[model samples]
Target: MYRILIADDEPMIRKGLQKLVEQSGQSMTSIRTAENGFHALQQIQEERPDFVFTDIRMPKMDGLELCRQLAELDSDIQIVVISGYGDFEYAQKCLSYGVKEYLLKPVSKKAVHDVLDKLVRVSARQRTDTFVPVSRLEQWIAEMDDLVWSLREPELELLLEKLRKELHHYSLKLARFCDVLEELNLLLAKRLSTRDVFSLQTHLDLGGARDVEEAWSRFAEGIWSIVRDLKARRKGRAKDPVEEAKHYIEEHLAEEVSLEEVAEYIGLNASYFSQLFKQSTQETFVQYRTRRRMEKAKKLLQQPHYRITDISGEVGYADHPHFTKTFKKYTGFLPSEYRQNLGIE
Candidate 1:
């Protein structure tokens, strides 16, 4: 029992879209049409429809303005914009105002049906409160972190496959799906100690990704490329000094290790090592060391036998207040709070 409204100056275009929706066989309590954005706004105020489809160019107000108004009035209302090739820029602006879908002019029946199907699925999920939770997202990030750290190619592929299925099942909005990909990118970058040279924004061409399938294909390819590059580099002839540095850091987690100390251990000058480390890893030597220490602290916090002060010292933090502040910043939880969440006494 959902209400839908279509707004367009062109009578034929409005009628065609209405017919297309009706022909798609999706259940709707009512289907209304308006001649322009002003009329559409009036209709929306009188009866807030669950969905809106408006042409970019209308009489009183344009689709972009209409979208802005609707967003302010009701954040939950799903909006789809109808635009021509010339309105491409306007369409992108509409997205920022919470328009969920866009249809190019000469909209095909198949495209309309596809958009409707996605809206229906998303609406159903909203009703059921089935969106992916924050805890589940964190769990996924942790699993990805482990996979990247281990450098297990097969396992990583399997994980990506499962992730792809989850993305499809959720039928998330394009922006939300991209946000997840960005998080995965950052997690992999940090774990691999590599700079994010392959960000989705710069590396992947996802502008044409109208559906989950298209977007995921490009995203998966980008991830696979990163994996392949890392494997090839690992097997390359030159020994990786960054890997050696990481090993030294791990071994000296309980001690204060300086850049000069690690550089001397790896037989490189301190200044050269600092630059090389940043080039190989996205983070500087100090940032990497701090992250490793925080990760170790998280693990130790899970053990009830370890006192908070002892754990802090074990991870190179001599000051208890400093340790608590750093731990809270790193994990969004104080050490004690983290342990309590784990049910560890």
Candidate 2:
């Protein structure tokens, strides 16, 4: 449901817009009204509605000026100009500010309904189709709220892998997006989400981000709210013990380790941990660790500077025969076969 703000100097016009929004077929949760632009700006700053409808000619500030101030505050806020026919030029100017719709007064219920319909549909598409969630697109907000955050290369890599699982729901667009995300650094990666693009662009346009770290914190928080909610929905929990285990496995891929030892470290019994890990990650602990080792071995094999035995050992295998057997079991080929397939001499 979209939240709407109505700003008109005339009480009847404001009330009429609010009634149109409430009676419209589309869902609109909240309606706030202000008699003038200054009051409208105050209300907007406080509540931050999804859609704003303001008359172009008001006593205190007017719709165009209010729209300009809102653009300064957040480029994402949608503004709809309620204007007289003579105010076409003013409405045209507000277009550069990203106003959603403009309706001529005396406004009809149908006209307001049409504007609300467009706002709801466009907003919904932007929310679902975009990489970032609509509500919490600011990373700093999520960080301050004590949500999960990722910025460092290794942490971001882990996040990308998790996002892969998430992309199953949005697979069509996610393929290209995930590829782009794979190569982006912390700041660039945060900016990749289309929902943040406008706001970040505005931030860059104004001046240099003096408190980049603080801004990053806010942006990370926003990303986390989406991921955390999705994680909660699919997994039925806010925290995933399996994800924790996967992180440990990735960190320790080069060390000789076993599920039993990992279970001991985390204070869970081996059998239970194995079940939960498989449930969360869709791979058993043994399979996950073995795959990590194979991935590392593949990277090392590409070097050609390292012997197979040394590479296998470097990835936690002590016995050459056992390592080859497990690698073949997982990859459907021996280590040499994998290297040869890559055309590596």
Candidate 3:
């Protein structure tokens, strides 16, 4: 069982996400809500939740700052960003701060349940990830990436053994430690073929390990787990990344999304995702996004209550004239003209 902390300025959002998570049937020790990032941090320090679901826009600290600070802490708190359709671009930025998972504004039970599922699977031992501020890990990242990528077990073993011997020479300070850990996490994430970003932290206790041998064992196990999981995947057919990208695009029709952001979201190289997307859908990512936006705009235009100006923003077109031109090009009718034919002034 684990605890969860939900943070948002909107009381309704906080309450709604909390309700969905409760209904997800995940074992939870406690569930709490915070009005803003400040309160969220306070709860984080006091309750020590295993997961945090936060919104990008909040009253005091905002999700960006909250995540930035949390990224620096030597804890294993999984963060999931929640944002409105229009704020996805901003929400997407949170991924850089040691966050790999996010849910759109309209929270679904399946999304909530899926994130919890990943947490459970990764934490099978009830203790899989706990980051430490160690400097030596940074230098080994490039070499380790090659070793893990090629699945060179012997070289990998030799490297870790050498690393184990040098652990005693390292000295850690909080300020510098967090930066190193963050860098290590990001670097490893780039090399990983996992579905999304997952952290690589040692299982050793935060304060101390029983002995040097125990610490080395815990750290080595974490590294080996990556190589083993990749080996297993190589034997099986990987899931279709293009389908996942399409779903992500359909959900974020309002945000200004780029090919790179979507690629990073699903843990694929941008160039690779581009090639696969075109081969599968016969449309470039840009072409797909444009078509989706026009479709969304048409639907909004059908609603008489939604103003033309607002409709443009809803479909990700900020400049009114540009949206008008694009709408005309897509449907051969301006938004105003389209609404006019529907008999609404």
Any residue pairs clashing in model 3, and if so which?
A: none
User: What ranking of all candidate models by lDDT puts the best one first?
Assistant: 1, 3, 2
Per-candidate TM vs. native?
0.38, 0.43, 0.38
**Per-residue lDDT of model 2, residues 5-91, tens digit only:** 899999988888888888897776689999999999887755557788889888979888998888876665678888888888868
* Steric collisions counted per model: 0, 13, 0
What would the per-residue lDDT of candidate 3 be over residues 258-297, giving only the tens digit for each residue?
9999877765667767876898889999999999999999
- Model 3: lowest-lDDT 10 consecutive positions: 202-211
Of models 2 and 3, which has the larger lDDT?
3
Best by lDDT: 1
Query: Once superposed on the true structure, which residue ranges of model 1 sit more than 4 Å away at CA?
Result: 130-345
Which whole-number lDDT from 0 to 100 does residue 10 have in model 3? 90
Best prediction by TM-score: 2
| lDDT values for all models | 0.78, 0.65, 0.74
Global local distance difference test of model 3: 0.74
Evaluated at residue 342, the lDDT of candidate 2 is: 85
Error of 2 at 14 (Å): 0.7
